[model samples]
Target: MASPKLTWNIALAGECMAARPFSVHDDEESMRVINLLRGADLTYAHLEMNLAHSRELEYPNRGDWLGSFMMADPAVARDLKWAGIDIMSVAHNHSLDFGPAGMLATKKHLQEAGVEAAGTGLDLEEAREPAYLETRHGRVALISTTSGNKPNEWASLGKGGYKGRPGINPLRASFNYVLTKEAAEQMKAIARELDVLRQADGSTMGTGLKDNEFSFQMPGDQSTRGSNVFTAGDHFEIQSRCHPRDLAGNLRSIDEAKKMADLVIVAHHYNIADGKRREKVPTFVREFAHAAIDAGADIYVAHGWHWTLGIEIYKGKPIIYGTGNFFAQSEFIRRVPYDSYESWGHDMDRLPTLNPADHPLHPGLDTHNEAWWTSALMGLEMKDGQFVSMTLHPVEMGRTAREGTITRQTGQGDHALTDGRPLLATGETAERALGRIQRLSKNFGTEVTIENGVGVIRF
Candidate 1:
C-alpha cells in the first residue's frame, strides 16, 4: 500500500487578547504608565472595559477579569476548529498583558483543545520555537513576532531582558550633568582610585571588575570624561529597542520548521495599516515584510490598527497590512442603557452625512454599524502571491446564549449577548456593508462588488 497524499486548507491570521472587564472609574494615569512600559495599553484597557460590561450583564456580578479571551469564549476556539484552522501565531503586544501565567494558560487551553500556538514559550528556547502542523497535502509552519523597542521585555513565555534583569540586553536610563573644570579633575582622581582598586582586586582576589560593573561604579565620571561629554543641554534616549538579532534568531527557528513543511506563514502584531489620516504606508512595515519574503516566507500578515489598510506585493509574495478585528467579543452593548438610542438602532447612515430620521436604527445600531466596518475589511486581500484580491466577511464576535432571541452587539463586537452566539449581517444592513466596501476600494485603485452579502475586490 502507498502513503496518502497531503493537502493543507487555510491559515487565518489576526489578534487576540486576554478578556478584561471595562473599568467604570477613570484609570488613564495607570493605563498611560502601562502603555509606556508595554506597547499596548489601549488594547488592555479595551479588554478591561469589555469584561466589566459582560460581568454586569451576567449577574451574581462579582467582577473578575477572565484572564484570556480564549478562555472566555470557547465558541471562538470551536469556530476555528470547525473551520479547520490548525495553527495560530500569538506574537501580539497584548499577549503579555495578563502576564506570563495568563499566556501559559491560554497556550495550554489551545493545546488541550487541539490548536497549535506559536511565537511565545516558557524560556528563550521555547519563545524561539515554531509551531508545526501536518496535513495530507503538506506541512505548515506558523511563526509570529511583536514590534517596537522592547519585544523581549514583553515576551510572556520566556525570561525577559531588562536592565538589572537576568535576560539579554537590558534597557537602562540615566542623566549626567556637565561638571565644572575643577569637578572634572576631582572625578578623574576618583576614577584613578577606582582603577587602583581594580588592579588590587585583579592581583589579590584574582577577579577583575566586569566592564559593565566598572561603568556602573562611576557613570557620571565616565560620562564627563568621554569624547562626547555630558552637559545639561545633552539628552539621551535609551529605549530598549528590539534587536534584529533577536528577530533573526526567532526567524531561524521558523526556518527550521519551514524545512519540515511545504508552506511557511509568518504573522506579526504590528501597525502595518496606516490610519485614515495617513496616505502613505510606514517604511518599517514595507521593509520588514520584504525582508521576511526575501527570507522565504509565503505570506506575511500583520494586525494592530483597528481598521484594515493596504496590501502590497513584495518579490512575488503577499503582505497583508492589517486584517482589522476578527471575532472580537466586545462588551460595549452592555454598558449603554437598553432604552437609549444606541440600543434601538439610531445611528445607521448610508452616506457620509447621516440623518437620524432617515436611518431610524442609527441610535440602536452598534454591531450593525460594525457590520459595515467588517464588510469594508474584505477589500484587503492577496492573490497568487501578488496584491490581487480582497474580500470581507462580516462576522459577529460572540455565540448566542439562546436560540431565536435577538441580542445587541458588544463594544468589541465579539458576541451577541442574548444567546452569546455570533451574529451575521443581514437585510439592508448587509447590503450596505457590501456597498461600503465597493466604495472604499475605489480610493485604492480597485473595484469591489458584493453578492449574497459577500464583498469581492477585483484588481
Candidate 2:
C-alpha cells in the first residue's frame, strides 16, 4: 500500500459580517453554499467585524473618526461554524471597534466556535503569531494583518518600564498628499493658525489637519525621518509602502509557518485603488503579496475595501487581491454608539429609524449598489505539494424586502435591506457575476473560463 496522493481542497472568502444567526431552515441555495465550504479540506475567510454580545462602547478608545461601529452578534459565529469555516483572519479596521476587550471577546467566541483566528492578541508578538488548522490532508497555517488601523489600536510592546497594549496585528502605512500651490499655501496658513509646526522642544503635529497636502515633519534624533505630510505639485501622486516592522514581522511569521504547516495563507487588509476603479490593486500590495509568496505563502489574499479586485499568479501561486464580502450584515446591526451618529453630523435626538440607504453612516448597505451584493468563493486544488487550479464560485448575497422577507438576488436589489448571507448564483446570474470576475482579473494577467456555472482557472 502507498501513501495517499495528499490532494487538498481549499476555499477562501473575504470580510464576513454575519450579524444574523442562521438556522436549519436556511434555504437550499444557502445550504449549497455551505456545502461547498464544508467540502473543502480547509476553508478560510476574513472575519471583518468583532463578535460580541453587548453593544456598549467602553474603554478609553480613539477611533471616533470611523463614524461607525461594526459589531456582529457572537451567536453568528455558530453560523460560520455550521458553514464549516476552519480558519479566519480577524485583524482589520473594525477589529477594535468596541475596544480591545471587544476584540478579545471576539477571539474567545471564535475559539469556542472551533474557528482558529490570526492577526490579533494581547501583545505585538502574539498578534503577529501564526494560527494553524490541522486537517487530515495537511496542516494549514494562517497569518493575517491589516494596513488600515487606528494608531491607538496597534498592539504595543511593554518594555523598559512601558505598558504593553492589547490589539490586532497591524501592517501600518502612511499617506502623503500632494496639492496645487494655492491649496498648499492655504494648508500652510491653516497649519500655522492651528500651531501644527513642532517647536524646538519637539512636540507632536496636529491630528485635525483638514488639508491632506499639508507637509509637516516631526523632528528626529539624527534625521527628520517622520512622514512628510504634503507637497505642492500640478498632478498629485501618493506613495505607499508597508511599514518596515509590520512587513518584517509578518514575513517572519510566514517563514515560521512554512516550518510548521504544509500550506500557508497570508491575509492582509488594505485598500489601494486605481483612481475611481476600486478594484485596482496597488503597487505596494502587489509587492507585498509577491514577497509573501516568496517567503513561503502558498496563497496570498487581500481584502477590506469591500469590493472584488483583481488576481495575480506569481511563481505558481495565486494572489487574490480582494474577495469582496462573504457576508456584509452591517445594515442589520441593531445598535451603534451615539458618537458614531454624531460623527456623521446627525442629531442624536432625531435618530432616524430609516434603513441603511437612508442613513448617512451606511450608504453601502443600499441594495442598489450591485458590487456590494456580489462576491465569489474561491476553491483552490493542490496536489503533491504543487499547484493545480482554482474554481470561482459566484455567490449572490441575500437581500431583505421592504416587507422584511428575504429574497435571493443577483446584481442590483430592491431598496430593501440586505440580509447578507451568501448563496450560490445560478442561471444567467452566475454567468454575469463570474464574467465580471473574469474582467476584473484579466488586467492582472490571470484568465478564467466559465464552465457550467463556476469560473475555472486551469494551470
Candidate 3:
C-alpha cells in the first residue's frame, strides 16, 4: 500500500558501536541530542556492534579479520530503542565479531527491544531483503548492505545439499591500482623475476604477474576478478568497482521496497576509503549510491569511515555520504578475546590481563584523531514523496580538555560509559565540525549554510 502523498521527518545517525547500555540521562546537553532523535517521525542508526548474552557466547573472538571485536550487552538494544532509534542497519565489518551465535543473539535482542534490523539474516536472500517499519504517518522501508564484509563472511544460499551461511548481505567491491606506463613495465619485469605470470601453455598473461588479473587489465576491457592494475595515463591511484551481481541484487531490493512503502531508505556500510584517506567517499560508492537512487531509494546513507565526510543532492533527494561514529565506546568494552591482545603483540600467558585502555591500542586506533571524534546527525524532511529540507546537527564524542588527550585518562576498573557518549555540539566545536562537513560537501557541489549551530544544506 502506497500513500498518494508522504510527509514526515527522519533522523539519521552514522554508526552505534556502543559496548554498554545507555539511557536518557539528566544531563541537559545529552538530553538535547536524545530529544532531537525523539522529535523525528522515524529514527535510524547503524548498529555496528554485536549483542552478546554473556562473555561465553559473545566474546570468543569469532571474526577472523584484522578489525577489532565489537560486542555490547544484549540489553544495549533496549537502550537504542529507548533513545528513539526505530531501525538499525547491522551490516558492517564488526557485525560478526562473535560469529553466528552472537549475531543471532543480537537479532533476537533487537526484536525483543522492538527495534527493526535490516541487512543480515539466515541467507543471502533474507539478508538482501528490505525490512519495513510501520508508523502512523507512513510505512518506511529500509534496505541495508555493506561493502566491507570479509571474503568468507557473505550470506550464501544453500546449493545442492549444503546449508546456507548465516551472515550479512554483501555489496562486494574490488580495487584497481591505476599505474603509469613506466610503472606497468616495471611490474612486468618483476613478474619475469617472480615467474608467476605464465600458464602451463607457455602463453604470457597480462603483465605476467602473479594474480595477473590484479597486476594488469586490458585497456577498455571490463574489469575482472581480484584487484587489477590499469595503466591510465601518467598517474597512480587506486580505483574501486562494485561487484555487478551484488549491486544488482541490492537494487532489486530497493525497487521492491519502494513499491511497498511510502519512503525507502538505503544504508550502505563501506570501509573502502578514497585511497589511504578515510574521510573521502570512494567513487564506487557514489556510483552504486546513484544506481540505488535510480532504482527507487528515497534516501542513501553511508557509514563506516568513523568520520564525517559529506552530503549530496541527487534527483531532488538527499544522499548522505558519511555521518561518522555515534555511541563510539569501542575502548570501553568489558571483555575482549585473546586475539585482541595478540594483535597488540601482548602475550596474555606471560603477562597480567589488560583492558583496551591499557592494551596498547588506547585512545583507540583513530580516537586520537580529531575527525574520528566529531560528526553530525542528518535531519531530513519529506513531503509528497519529495525532499523538503536536510540539516546537519554537529555532534562530538571526545574529551580534548583533559590534558590535551583524546579522552580523559582512563582509570582502572571503570567502563567509562559517561565519557564516550555523543552530545550536541556548540560554540567553536560546532563551527570546526560543521566547517569540515561544509568543505567536504563542497567537493560534490553541495552547499551547506551554518544556521545558528546547525549545518543546513540548501537544495
Best candidate per lDDT, number?
3
- Single out the weakest 10-residue window by summed lDDT for candidate 2: 400-409
- Across residues 319-351, which tens digit of lDDT does each residue of candidate 1 receive? 666554544433322222222233344443423
Winner of 1 and 2 under lDDT: 2
List the candidate 2 regions with Cα displacement exceeding 4 Å: 1-5, 55-63, 176-214, 217-236, 271-277, 350-361, 399-415
**TM-score against truth, every candidate:** 0.52, 0.84, 0.89
RMSD (Å) per prediction: 15.5, 5.6, 4.4
Runs in model 3 deviating more than 4 A are 55-66, 198-225, 228-233, 355-357, 362-367, 400-418
Error of 2 at 277 (Å): 6.2
What is the per-residue lDDT of model 3 for residues 338-453, given as tens digits with 9 covering 90 to 100?
A: 77776666676854656556544433453256666678888898877678888889887765422224443345554343356778876677788889999999988889899988
| lDDT of every model, 2 decimals | 0.43, 0.76, 0.78
Cand. 2 Cα-lDDT: 0.76
Off by over 4 Å in 1: 1-13, 16-79, 148-152, 156-243, 271-280, 332-391, 396-453, 457-459
Cα shift from native, residue 284, model 2 (Å): 1.6
Ordered from best to worst lDDT, the candidate numbers read 3, 2, 1
In candidate 2, which residue pairs clash?
none
Question: lDDT per residue, candidate 2, 311-407, as tens digits?
Answer: 7788888889888887877766666666667666676677675333436665465345555667789999877655689999988776322222347
